[model samples]
Target: MPRFTAQELDAHRAKVTQLLDKPSIKVGMSTCGVAAGAVLAFDTLVEEAKSKSANILISRTGCAGMCSMEPLVEVCIPGQPAAMYGNVDAELARRIINEHVLSSQPIVERLVPSIEALAVAYDKSDTPTPPGASGPRQYRIVLRNCGVIDPESIDEYIAREGYQALQKALSGMTSEQIIEELKVSGLRGRGGAGFPTWHKWQLTRDAQGDEHYIICNGDEGDPGAYMDRSVLEGDPHSIIEGMIIGGYVIGARQGVFYIRAEYPLAVQRIEKAIRQARAAGLLGKNILGTEFSFDLEIRLGAGAFVCGEETALIASVEGKRGTPRPRPPFPSVKGLWNMPTMINNVETLANIAPILVRGGKWFGSIGIGKSTGTKVFAVTGKIKNSGLVEIPMGTTLREVVNGICGGIASGRRVKAVQTGGPSGGLIPEQHLDTPVSYEHLQALGSIMGSGGMIVMDDTDSVVELSRFYLGFCVDESCGKCAPCRIGGTQILRTLNRIADLKGTERDIATVRRIAHAMQKASLCGLGQTAPNPILSALRYFEPEFMERIAAAKTARKEPGIARK
Candidate 1:
């Protein structure tokens, strides 16, 4: 409600941080949390707090990545440890208010260690702690404020050093200096490609344009991928601040957030964050009382997967059909009304704030070679702790599957792991010990696509999984090119035959030939990577396909015998 200068903002952070000295109650209110009945629990806590006349602050924050235990509630008393409870409801809310808030006695049955506390434990141990008994250690950097701060309140974000990065850039650093810091930090685009963020920003800045634009690609279409959505919902201001810093570096005066319409909650939170930011002198004219000025608006996408591509995203933002064009004159040169445009995904923008606050060298020293900083993954499917996990880049698949996610839900052997959604390939169980760097995932015939990791157990069939992913690609393909449109259909047919236990070696060979053509001839990323799932399945699980074919032959030989 008040416009703040640079000095005033700092003073306000000190005042807001003092509130932590008192008891506070925070409810997980993001999409995952709300779906698990967090809304009812939140209302109950507010009502019960009023009835009991409890002197506590009740607030709602974004998901902390543990979606398996939703309707989560966190309580922090002065002397006692901060406790997080999952699967909370109205009844639990009442008990928490009366027993935990009023009496200061924590409910052991519902208590889970805070992520920050667990990080301390992890730092002290050589071996990572396994999931289930304790939630996995998620080395959070981009998700530092998620599930910790009230997303609706700008002050909470500021208290945690949110816009200070933007302040430093606007008041102190030049555009080139910011790009150089990003380069030194080794920050890459988190939107599947792993391209250098610094290079893109530099190119956009150097491009010829009187007016430039910055676009935040929040249209996360990858199935099982919700990292971008959570960031948008839980820490919208981080993206805002990141964009402001980006706008300053790129010399862009206007920005746009291209989020899909399906994520209504994310859109709403972002819109609210934009308004709050404007009121606080963080978004509009003369931000932080500096000469630098920037404005932002939201553009709802139609849930097209191809729009995730830069050219298609730019076209969609300009009110054109969402399809990818040739890439000779990329978006950096001529984009969005024939002006230079710099586009980064939600997670990529979120990293900018932290990188600026902590020097580039500090971030660069965290992760392994070339892949610095933490990566947030939406780990789902047949896993005990199915939720979000953020670990350093060099962490092994074994650590993620066995330690963080608690191996398999059914306690069965792992069949394979799927990363990058429809576009990514499968990593067999044999490679579980492999580290999860971008190059390593690519070497394993998959990619680090937008951080969607689905763990599969032995009960699952690899051929069927490949078919399903290929089918999704076929259905979602933009159909702008023949290689992706027709090749995807042919690959899907071969996969269906193999999955049905009726494919021969010739059929397999035909599919492989088609896959290679699509990979080479497809116009955009959608077509080029559409056959990844099938190719990886064949590469790692060809024996299974042969076994199915043998069974089909035996069934045909014995007319009266039923197929096993």
Candidate 2:
């Protein structure tokens, strides 16, 4: 591919936009989909389309974020509503081809509309309902390309206005201009903490360092979270482009993706994307024939949860054991090889290109205050349409759980929603109406940690759920610090005692006390928030704990003692 200047790139973007007039079918082929046999379905559609000489375009994309309904197949035929079919098997694939592709008739019963569809539907409806009138609707910004384009192929991504963001950033904007745009956009770090993106870039940019490195955090160890994985698998280039843009801003020349080895498909796609980008002269020295020189490589993680932390991630990249060190000399100050570094999660980086392309204010205006831009959530656990969902920030849990997720499966009452993985807290039904912003979630005792929202129904026990997450933290604890290693273990033991119906009220108080201390004194985030699940559970479900204790007391007494 020949390098194009700014005007030429704009012309090419217009050309690409015209090509989108053609119809297509996109299959959600991420890990969630593959686990539900989407690969076979993808193959079946390709094979059948070829055999029957169907003109329909069959393409494989990443997860749409609705995890519970894996094997999602989206059909888009001209003048017909685009529809997504979930829980699709080979037989269903054949039916989708026959009914939707060939006949152009939408399979309404199997159809789950995209957020775009919801917006359109809302506009047409007489009642001024929020988008996603048929069910629930969410806006897609961070995950704009996921489940919409083939991740492994750069051409598919470019065809859908993918690298256009990078071109816009490189050709039209200066580093300071780009950083200022980010500040205006109100974008924050998606890797937990919710730090402003522009401020992070400015810090590294201003920090004294001739050598700088940019790391993409793909070590997603959150138990029910796969948002990062889906982004990596579905739209790897968005991240690559985002990283490149980040490198350009921070004056960094090298980029590394610290991805966990567990996501073989994500790893494979990213590797392929890097090779494609380099071949296209989008990576390596003097990108797009510009003076900017940036190169990227992949570093596999050993699947340690703590490695998700920036310092530990840096350590793992440097061929050391993945262990976090003390902050103050933050990664921005002294990171990998003790040079200045800027680290962003896969999802956070994915947003960069779009923010630059559309301008910061455009991106910022979509969501609620402070929490600008869309967030991609891996909605799992007991929901009917569990998958990856990207909605604009400030969308309520009620809209997400009841509307988009189709509520708990089989009309079950939703018990609670768990966000931020094991280190995050649970929000009971009373707070369902609360809008999901960084502040609102934190106020409700939950942080939006990497957008892992696990919805639980009546069938789930709050105590059991807290114990499960606490147990996960206990196992994944690096043990480098006493707070995480020892305190996490103690908290788990207390929660286990409660779950096993062997606890008193004092035990609840003890759990809270330990959680407070861990939060205040722990060496790292792992140690600090390790007790979140326990404390949140105690705060929201104290009655459940009391019931367990009462039951234990009843079970311990003899029949004669009970009579007395």
| C-alpha TM-scores of all predictions | 0.96, 0.92
Q: What is the per-residue lDDT of model 2 for residues 1-564, given as tens digits with 9 covering 90 to 100?
A: 555554665666677665555678788888878888888998999888888788888888887766667778888766765688878888888888887788877677886656455432211322223444453356666666777777877777777667787887777688899999999989999987899989999999888887999999999989888888878898899899999999999999999998989999999999999988887778987787789889999999997998988888899999998899999799998998999999998888988887776678777777788898777788888888787777777789998899777898879899999999888999999899998899999998899898899999888888888888888888888889887888888988877777776777798888888888888988888888888887888789889989998876875675554345
How do the residues 431-532 of candidate 1 rate in per-residue lDDT, one tens digit apiece? 999888889999999999999999999999888888888888899898999999999999888778767866777888999999999999999999999889
Q: How many residue pairs in model 1 have overlapping backbones?
A: 0
What's the lDDT for all of these models? 0.87, 0.82
Model 1 residue pairs with clashes: none
Model 1, residue 196: what's the lDDT? 96
TM-score of 2: 0.92
Clashes of each: 0, 12
Name the regions of candidate 1 deviating beyond 4 angstroms.
120-136, 559-564
